[model samples]
Target: MKRINLSDKVITALKSDIASGKLKKGTKIPSEPELMERYEVGRSTIREAIKTLAMSGILKVQQGSGTFVASKIKSETLAQRLRRADFEEINAVRSLLEIEIVRLACLNRTDKDISAMQDHLIQRKKAIETDQQQKCTDADIAFHVSIAKASKNKVLVDLYQNFTSVIRDFFTKRKEENMTYFARSHKWHEELALAIINRNQESAVQLIKTLLNNNY
Candidate 1:
C-alpha cells in the first residue's frame, strides 16, 4: 500500500472526528496554531491539510474566520463515509443499485453480454465445486458487473465497480461463516443468468434481491 503523508493523515483524522459527531456540520475546526500543536505538525503541513479538506468539500475556509465543517459535503464525500460502513449497510445500498441494474440489463442486454454473464456463471459454479473461495468471489463479482455492463449505463457500471471491494468483503465473511454459501450462490447465479437472458425483468430484479438478502 502507498504510504499516507502527514497531511493525508490529518485529513483522515478530521474526517473521522466529523463522522463520529465530535465535529458536527458547520462546527469550526481547530485553528492552525491549535491544530499544529494537536497534531504536532508545522504550519505548512496544517495549512495543506486544511486546504485539502476544503477542496474536498469536507471543510469550508474563511479568510477572516477559522475553518468550519461544510454545511453540505459532496456526494463523493458521502461515499467515503459509506466506505467505512458495516456490511449490512453496504449490502442494502448494493441491492438497491443492482436491482435497477438488473432491470435495465433485461431490457438492454445484447447477445454478447448474455454470453459473458453465462461464462461468469459457469466460472462461479466451477470455483464453488472446487472450493476455491477467492476464485468464487471474483467470479461472483464479475457476474454482477457483467449485468451492470449490460445495462448500457457507464455511470452504473462504474458505481458497481467501485462497490466491488465491499461486495467481496461481504462474500468473504459469509463464506467463512457458512461453508455452503458459494454452493447456494452458484445456483442463484444460474437462475439469474437465465432470467437476464430471457429478458424476464421482474424475475431478474427479484432474483438479485433474493440473493442479496441471503434467501438463496
Candidate 2:
C-alpha cells in the first residue's frame, strides 16, 4: 500500500469533504498548485492525492470546465463512506483536537457562557433521568457545543460540530449494545462542566480526554 505523505494531509480531508458536500458538488476546489501550497507538499503528492478520488468515480475531469463532481446528490455525500473509516484513526484525531479545544474554551468562556452550559447540563440531566435517551444524547452534544462556542473562535466551533456528528453516531451505536454507557457519560460530563465553569483549563482538558479515551 502506498503511504500518505504528512504534508499533504489535506488531500484526504478535501476528497472526503468534497464527496460529503461540505465542499459542495460541482464546486471547483482550488487548483493543484493551491492545494499543494495549502498542504505544503510536492506536486507529485498532490497529483496522487487527487487521483484517489478520481479513481473512486466521485470526481469527473472535464477538459475545459475542470473537474466536476458526480451529478447525483446522494453520491456527493460521504456519510456512508465515513461509516467505513477506521474507528481507531477517527478516535486518534478526535482526541488530539478536542483536548486543546476544551483548554481554549476554559480560558475564554464568559459568565454568560457558563450559564448556557449550565442550562445544557440541566437539560442533559433531566433527559436522562426521564429516560429520554435520544434527547439525552442530543443534550449531551449541546452541552459540549456550548463549551466549544464559549471558546469564542468560529473555526473551533465549526470543526467541533463537524467531527462531533461522527462521534455522536459512534456513541449512539454503542448505546444500542450497552445501555449503561449514558450513566457513566453523565457522571463524566458533570465533572467536565464543573471544570470548565471553574476556569480550570487543565482539569477540563484532562477530563475530556479521559472520557474520550474510555471508549477504547
Candidate 3:
C-alpha cells in the first residue's frame, strides 16, 4: 500500500518538476537508489513510478542510459497548460492583442480589405444554413482570418490564425454543444464588420471582447 501511494506521489512530483523546467528535457533522472533515498521510498516504488511516466510519454527510459524527461514533451503544449486556459479566456488574449491590430488596420486597411470582409460575411451567412458542417467551420475561420489580415501586419495576422486553430480544437473536443453559439457568434461578427467598416477602432475592439464574453 505504501509502495502504491509512493509510486503515485513520485509521479506527481516528477511531472510538476518537469513542467516547471526544473527537470530539463532530455536530462536524466537520478538513479532508483538516489530517488528512493531522496523521496524516502522503496526502490520498487521509484522504478514503478518511472515506468508509468515513461509509458505516458512524459519520460524516456533508455536501458542502462537511465530515465530522462522526454525531449518532445513540453509544458506549453501539454494538458497542464490547457488546464490553466479556460474557454473564452483566449478571447481575452485576443482582445488585448487585436485591439492594437485594429488600431493599425484603421490606418492601413484599404478598399480591398473592406471588399474581402464583405465577401467573407456573405459566404459565412450561406454556410450557416448549409447542411455541411465543415463548410460552416471553414467559413468561421475565414471570417476571422480576413479581419486579422486587414490589420496589414503579417505577424499579427499569423498569430491570430494560430490562436484560432487552438480555439477551434477546444470547441471540437467538447461534448454537448448548441448551434446557438454559432448564431450568436455570427451576429457579433456582423457588428464587428460594421465597426471596422466605419473605422471605429475602439468600438470594434470592445464589441469583439463583449461578443466573446457573452457568446459562451
Candidate 4:
C-alpha cells in the first residue's frame, strides 16, 4: 500500500481530535512546534495540514495569534462540503443536477437564455484556441450556469451556482495535473446548446449525459 503523506496524516489526526471533542469549537489548536513534536512531522507538514483544514473550514487561522477551531466546526455548507469531496462524489451529484437542468431548460428556456449560452460557448472556444486554461474553465462553467438559469427554477439555479464554485477547483487541479478528464469539447458543448435552443428535451439530456461521460 502507498504510505499516506505526512500532511494528510496530520490532517486525519486533527480531524479525529475535533470529532472526538478533544478540540472543541473556538479553542485554539496546539502551536506549530507542539503539533510538529506531537505528530513527529516537520514545520512544513504541520503548516500544510493546517492550511488544508483552514480551506475546508474546519479550522481558522488568526494571524500572529494562532489557529483555532472554527466557531461552526464540521457544519460546513453544501459548497464547502463539496469542495472537500472526492471527484467521483462531486461528479455524481453534478450529473444528477445537470440532467434535470438540461431537461427543464429545454422546456423553459427563453431566446435570451439561449443567446447567453451561445455567447459563453464562443468565449470558451476562444479560450481553448488561445490555450488559456483558466479562461476556458471559467467560460465553460458560465455556459453551464446559463443553462441552469434557463431552467427557471430558483432553487436549482442556486444549487448549480454553489456546485460550480466547488467544481471550479476540480477543473483547475486537473489542468495542473495534466488530466484530460475535464478538458473542453467544443463540439459536444455546441450540440448540447443547440439542443436546448431547439427545445429538444430528449436530445439535450442525451447530449449532456454523453458529454459528461466522455471524460475528455
Q: For candidate 1, lDDT tens digit of each residue in 80-198?
A: 55678876777778888899999999999999999999998888888878888888778878888999999999999988888887766566667774338778667777888899999
Worst 10 residues of 4 by lDDT: 176-185
Q: State how far residue 56 of model 2 sits from its true place (Å).
A: 9.0
Models sorted by lDDT, best on top: 4, 1, 3, 2
The sequence of per-residue lDDT tens digits that candidate 3 reaches over residues 11-53 is: 9888878878888888998888888888898878888999899
Q: Residue-wise lDDT of candidate 4 within 26-102, one digit each (tens)? A: 99999999998999988988999999899999999999999999944354477877788887987888899999999
Collision count for each candidate, in order: 0, 0, 0, 0
Task: Indicate the worst ten consecutive residues by lDDT in candidate 1.
Answer: 71-80
> Can you list the residue pairs that collide in candidate 2?
none
lDDT of 3: 0.75
- In model 4, the runs with Cα more than 4 Å from the true position are 1-74, 176-184
Each model's lDDT comes to: 0.82, 0.75, 0.75, 0.85
- Count: clashes, candidate 2: 0
Tell me the spans in candidate 2 whose CA falls farther than 4 Å from its real position: 1-84, 177-179
